[model samples]
Target chain A: MERWQVVTVVVAGYLLLTLLIGLFAGRRVSASVAGYVAADRQFGLLAQYFVTGAMIFSAFAFLGGPGWAYAQGAAVFYILSYGVLGIAPWYVLGPKAGRLGRRLGFVTQAQLVAGRFPSRSLSLLLALLSVAAFVPYIMLQMSGAGIVFRAVTDGHVPFWLGAAVSYLVVLVYVLFGGVAAVGWTNVFQGIIMMSVAWGLGLYIPIHLYGGVGAMFERIADARPELLTLPGLNAGGEPWSWGAYSSAILASALGFTLWPHLFMKSYTSRDDDTLRRTVILFPTFQLFLIPIFLVGFAGVLYPSPPEAPDFIMPHMILQTGLPALVVGLFCAGALSASMSTGDALMHAAASIAVEDGVRPYVRLTDAQQRLLMRALVVVVGAVAYYFAIVQKQTLVFLLLTAYGLVDQLAPPVYAALFWKRATTPGVLAGLAAGIGADLFFFWQRDLRPFDLHEGILGALANTLVLVVVSLFTAPQPEAHATVYVEPEEEAAGATVEAVA
Target chain B: MRARTARRLAIAFFALYALVLTYPGVLPFNRIRPLVFGLPFIMFWVALWVALAGVTLWLTHLAARRERRGR
Candidate 1:
């Protein structure tokens, strides 16, 4: 058989395995909305660990990470630095949020906020913003899948067919299993990604340059610029420290605030499970080291890929590795894309129904579950159509989405910790923060010191939240205490009972 | 150590990590030479901090657990 055919068969085998795991896992959950949206709040340490890691390191990390390392050099280090910083706060916030979620029956980030603040429009706004961010983000994951298939299969499978087929599999499991399927498949995918990343990461450099040190030594002699921090910009110009530092700061702040990630706090089996997940998180962050090595291996290769993003597949194919290895690599890349894509689809649909529609229309629990399932398909179809048919670039929107997501942090912080935060203050702060972020995003040249728009927006958001909250009538003392200083002993007992 | 003190120290460590890994703080450590364990100095620097963060967080968890058991 031809090599591409062999590769295709292996990939097909992998996808079938993923489908079986997802479908099987789906059968174990209850049929309630909580079951679908929050995995019935029973994810233990292992489940929480893989789900969080796999979702965060998406097709972007698998493919774009190497691409950045290949073309731009150390600019990719910014990606490396922020993950721990982003997740560390979760150690404190995760259990606290989980406590609130269980008590209030909140399964979404906006629900958590609107629960504290009690505003319908605020919930609607959050739902809208989250979906806006999620659609383009999901579309990008599809594109990443298509890119891998097309690159590795020698274009036997076109981008459209590749993306459609893979996502069709994703839609099935997510529809049937809900978050349970997402969790289990992520466990499967997460293992594949780490193994392939390390296997190829180490193999590539040693095979080509004799050792990891040798590869770096050679690059240092030939392309030393790639070894330094705050690497080159898209234009290949030297990147300023201002842009680099702010990228780290903005991304770190916005990381856990992504609605999908924040909601994961609601999925943990117990507060301990959540805390342990945060502690174990850096091991996953270390996986990026191998991923970066794969990109650096391509730096001195005889030929260059058409685009830097193609570097990983380009290297695998160029090196003429065994057909089986090539196939395994393709499966790993798909895992990265599909794991993230499923989470986005599931979260977007859940958020839409829970926060977007439920407030305006009163629906039975059965009706709500049905609506969530239907919306999952709808969200998938829309993202797939844009990914395959319209083929628009969603990178700009994804970046803007980060800035928008950062605006969520202030309200969430106020809800859990600050007692004085009022509804009007939250609403006004969200509006001003989003406005400032957008203003700077569009007027890029006007930014002071080339700072990320998200940081600027956060500053505006906090300032407005503080000022506006002081001027407004405070929430009743009784209501504020429930969130700010809930009796820990009672909360812990309830959590244990539920578990 | 007291749970509160441990928590305070963990937060301080994370804050110091944020400072030293970015901007003016990172400026001193960012370099290609003096490769440690086959990684560039800056790369090693970032990885070291991340690993240390894990240790710090684990200790904080233990401290919190001890305090809770006492209560």
Candidate 2:
């Protein structure tokens, strides 16, 4: 059969399997709010890790990682650096977030912040920001599926049709099964993704360039700049280090702040589970080193400037490998993209219901679940529209969300750790940060420094939070106790009732 | 909570990471050697720290189990 035909069959089969699994998950779980949002909080470390891992992987790993490495060389190290930074902070924060979430019946990060501060407006604002930020992220994943479809089929299957077929499966499964389906599918997808990553990471290098050492040696001989730190495209300025380092810092700190990642904390069975997951998460980063090798190989291929992003797909095609192996590779890429898209769709829907709908309309457990399922379609369609329309670089789309998500952190950190942080202060700070980020992003051409627009926004946000918090009256001591106390002291008794 | 101890540990870890990241340049060129598993000495340390964290978490889990039993 033609490669495109093989691609179509393999992709269609994967989607069909996913839809069946999702429907099965829906039938298994009780149709309650807890079942829909938190998987009834029954998830253990293993399931939580897979879900979190798959969520973190995204299309960025399969497509953007190799693309960036091909174009920028060693500068791609910043991507892995962010992963490391992102996972490390979870050790302290994840447990605390999880503990509070369990105790307060919090379903989203917005709920956690809003409950703590007693500010419905702040919660609604965060819900809006989350939808706004995640829309582009969801779009990027859809676009990545489009890119993969176009590549494998050689443009036989249109991009929109490919995205529609894949995402419709995701929407069906996620709408039916809720977090349980998303988590279980993620486990299956995560294994496939990691195995394929390791296989390709080892195979392509050995197959094409003899071995990793030889691959690097050949690239170094041809383009010595490819292996060096700060890399070849360091612009003309020495101050690029500041920009790079800050970008890494912002990404690391900002990653855990994203709502989807934060929601994973709620899935963990205990504090120990959260810590175990964080400690083991770095192993996934080790898998990424090989994908970077594919980009390194691109140096020899000499890609066109306008089409650097397609280098990895082109390289994969050029291998003339068996259709089965190619199909498996495409399945792995789809896994990475769909896993992320499912989580984003679920999170966005939950945010709409928990933070947006719950405040305005009193929803029963069943009604909330139904509303969430409906919102899955709504959110997926909104994201699909953006995916079809927007043509920005994946990195640009990612950074835009990262900036807005980072704005959320100052308030979150304050609410968690500091007793003095007031509701008005957090609300004001968040507004300033988001406002500044949007303004700077619009005027990106005229920025004073080469730093990420988010960094500037974060600084303004932090300043406002500090200044306002100092002047405002503190939260009552009783209210602050909920966040500061240990899990056993705060929620052990209550959690037992639910369990 | 011992604020000073946590603060100190955080600072020490940050400093250690910074040194490890920059150590290739700090060391004499002739003295440096690629270590076990074909990774550079500095890169090996990154792997080491990651492994250490895994071990620490395992130990913490054990401790938590013991505490649960005691209760």
Candidate 3:
């Protein structure tokens, strides 16, 4: 058989297995919205861990990560830095949020925020912002899938067809199986992605340039700038310490705030499951070190790909590795892309139906499920269209939006820890943050020691929230304390039981 | 393994990780002249912290588990 045929055979087999996993995992799903959206809160330790890790790593970790290392060198370390710091805070927050979720029956972040603040308008605003955020986010994953498909097939599969095919499988399993589909598939995909990544990551360098050390050592002798800290900025100029430092901070702050990921609180079996997931996340984050090795392996090679993001697949193809390895590499890339893409599509549709539409129009459980299923299709189509038609602009938008996610940090912290936070204060803070984000984004400028636009926005958000909340009478102490100090509620329950 | 202690451990754990990512920018750990384990000083520094983070969180998890049992 021809080499491409072997690749086709391997990738085809991988896709079929993904579909089967998707279908098999949902056998226990009950006939209710909770079953569909929250996986009946039954995820175990390992599944929860992989679901969280695989979702966070995404296509970016597999494809874009290597691309960054190949192109920007040490700059990619910032990606690794933010992931651990960002998720560590979840250990404190997740169990508390999960307890509150059980009590309040909130499955979306907006629902949780709105429940605390007691504002439908706030829920409406959050619902809108989530879609705005998810569009580009999901599009990024789809575009990654498309790029991998086109490159792997040597353009036999065009961007549109490739994206549509992968996402078509995603929508089917996600439609049939909600959180279970996402969870089980992540377990399977995470295994494939991590193994393929480590194998290829070490193999390419050792085969081409002796080993990881030799590759970097050779690069240091030839092109020295790539190894320097606060490496080149996105524009290829020497990155300032100020900008590099804040980008790392902003990324960490924004990491867990994504509504897509946050909604998983309702899916955890208990607080311990969520906490264990957070504690074990660093193990998953370490996979990036190998991914970066793959990228750095591409440097100083006489010929280079047209773009940094293409390095992983390009090197795989060019190095003339066995067809089996190339095929596994393709599956690995697809695993990364589809794993995250499915979750994004799933979350966005759930938010649209539960938070956005249901509040405006009352719907029964069956109707809600139907609407959410229909929305999965609609949302996927729109993102797929954008993925094929406008890849560059959407990715640019995604980069800008990471900072905007930091805007959620202030309100979330208030809900979890501070008692005096008010509804109006959060609204003011959110608006101020988004406005600050836009102003800096349009100017393409980092401000105040080159802190990320998100961090800058968050600073403004916090200031507005504090000034407004102090002036406004705090939400009644009883209402505020329910979320602010859930431990009190637990103690009250114990007291009642004793009586 | 008091719950309070486990909570504090979690906080300290992240604080140490943040310091590694943050101080490196200010202090500039990017020297490649000396390769530790075939990685640049900065790269090795970050990688070392990642492994340390795994060990740290694992201990915290154990502490948290023991705290639950003690309760």
**Chain B alone, TM-score of each model?**
0.96, 0.54, 0.76
Chain A only, candidate 3, TM-score? 0.97
* Model 1: lDDT of residue A324: 99
Q: Put down candidate 2 lDDT per residue, A1-499, tens digits, no spaces.
A: 8887886788778778777876786677767887788887878888888888889998887788887777776556667656755666777788888888887787789888887888788989989999988999999899888888788788887789888888988988898889989988888889988998888877777888877667666766676554444443424222255455556667876888899889878877788888778768877777777777777677786444335556666777877777777777788888999999999999999988899879878878778888888999999998999899897767658877888888888888887888788888998999999989889889877655566778888889989998998899988887787776655345665887889
lDDT of 3 by residue, A1-499 (tens): 8777788789889999999999999777887888888888788898898889889878878878888777777777888778878887787778888889888888888888888987778888888888887888888888888878778778888878778888889999999988899999999999999999889888888889987888888999987888877777657788777777777788889888898888887899999899889878888988898888888888877789767777888888988899998899889888988888899899989999888887789899999999999999999999888777774632244556687788889989988888888899999999999899778866655466776788888999999998999999877777878898888877988999999
Residue A9 deviation, candidate 3, in Å?
Answer: 1.9
Error of 3 at A93 (Å): 0.8
**Segments of candidate 2 deviating more than 4 angstroms:** A232-239, A302-306, A445-449, A486-499, B1-11, B18-71
What TM-score, computed on C-alpha atoms, does each candidate reach?
Answer: 0.97, 0.90, 0.97
Q: Candidates' DockQ values?
A: 0.84, 0.22, 0.67
Task: Give the TM-score of candidate 1 (chain A).
Answer: 0.96
What lDDT score is found at residue A439 in candidate 3?
80
Better candidate by DockQ, 2 or 3 = 3
Best by DockQ: 1
For residues A57-76, could you state the per-residue lDDT of candidate 1 as single tens digits? 88888888898889889988
Candidate 3 TM-score versus the reference:
0.97
Which 10-residue span in candidate 3 chain B carries the lowest summed lDDT?
A: B21-30
- Model 3 CA deviation exceeding 4 Å by range: A391-398, B23-28
